[model samples]
Target: MITGDNQHAAMRVANHLGIAPELVFFKASPSDKKTVIQKFEQEGEKVMFVGDGVNDSPAMAQASIGVAINAATDITVQAAGIVLMSNDLNDVLKALAVSRRTLRQ
Candidate 1:
């Protein structure tokens, strides 16, 4: 996860999510998020970026799959490939599951 937040906050969220500390990018700007996605693409990785703030629009557009919450800014909504109707973050997992199932079919 790439975020503009400081290392402490970033680590806190990462730890809660069970993500590796090395995988978290702290003090990242929107452009930094885009760069991270680009780097992942260069490494042959598929990225799914989820965000809501206006600050997230560029990164959202840069992701392999961009997901936005319904309450996000218009710009974010426009940039996303998938916009969740509900603000619940768990819906992202559901969407991922459905996509995987569809792909298998």
Candidate 2:
């Protein structure tokens, strides 16, 4: 998972949900997102990016799928393919579960 200082609070929430700190890559610059996405794409992995901050909107738009919470900024909501009504970080796991199920079908 890719994140930024702007999402530190949310990352803390994600950590509570069992997403390890090692899995989280925190970037302070928006430019870092491109490199992160590129690296994932190079590995042939489909990456879903989620965030509520403006700095993350770009990566969100470029990701295979973007999830934005209702509490997020308007820009993030606009860029996201899935706009979650709930703010709970646990909802992200639900989304991933749904995606996995759909893919299997």
Candidate 3:
């Protein structure tokens, strides 16, 4: 959960989501986010970046699967491979499930 939010806020959100605090990157710049995605790719990991802000465009574009909410900035929408029309974060899981089903066909 890489975010531009401050460390304290990031930690709080991470804790609530059951994500490790060490896995939460706080105060991340756009470049930093992109770098992290690239690092994951280098390590043979597939990254799925979900974002709504203009600042997230770079990382979204760098991700293997970029999902943008319908309410996201134009740049973010353009950078994403998929857009969630409902603008609900949970829709990401639904989308992934559908994709997996489609892939199995």
Candidate 4:
């Protein structure tokens, strides 16, 4: 999880979500987020970026799968490959499950 939020707050959220501290990037700028996505892509990794603000647009566009929440900013929605109509973040899991099922078929 890469976030523009402060380190302490980002860490708290990462902990709650069971994300490892090494995987959490705090105080990240839009460019930083994009760079991270690019780096992962260079390493042959597929990145899925979930975001809801204009600041997230660039990174969203850079991701292999960009998911926008229903309440996300217009820019974020435009950049995302998938838009979740529901406000719940758990919808991301649902979308991934559906994608996996489709791929298996």
Q: Each candidate: what lDDT? A: 0.95, 0.80, 0.94, 0.95
Model 1 C-alpha lDDT per residue in residues 1-105, reported as the tens digit of each score: 888999999999999999998899999999999999999989999999999999999999999999999799999999999999999999999999999999999
As for candidate 1, its clashing pairs are: none
Query: How well does candidate 1 score on lDDT at residue 40?
Result: 98
Q: Write candidate 2's Cα lDDT for 67-91 as tens digits.
A: 8987889999999999899888779
Candidate 3: segments with Cα more than 4 A from true spot: none
Candidate 4 whole-model C-alpha lDDT, 0 to 1: 0.95
Roughly what TM-score does model 1 have, to 2 decimal places?
Answer: 0.95
lDDT of 3 by residue, 1-105 (tens): 899999999999899889987788989999999999999899999999999999999999999999999889999999999999977788999999999999999
Which candidate, 2 or 4, would have the higher TM-score against the true structure? 4
Candidates ranked, most accurate by lDDT first: 4, 1, 3, 2
Model 4 lDDT tens row, 20-58: 999998899999999999999999999999999999999
- For model 1, what is the C-alpha lDDT against the true structure? 0.95
TM accuracy, model 4 = 0.94
Cα-based TM-score, every candidate: 0.95, 0.75, 0.93, 0.94
Instruction: Report the poorest 10 consecutive residues by lDDT, candidate 1.
Output: 62-71
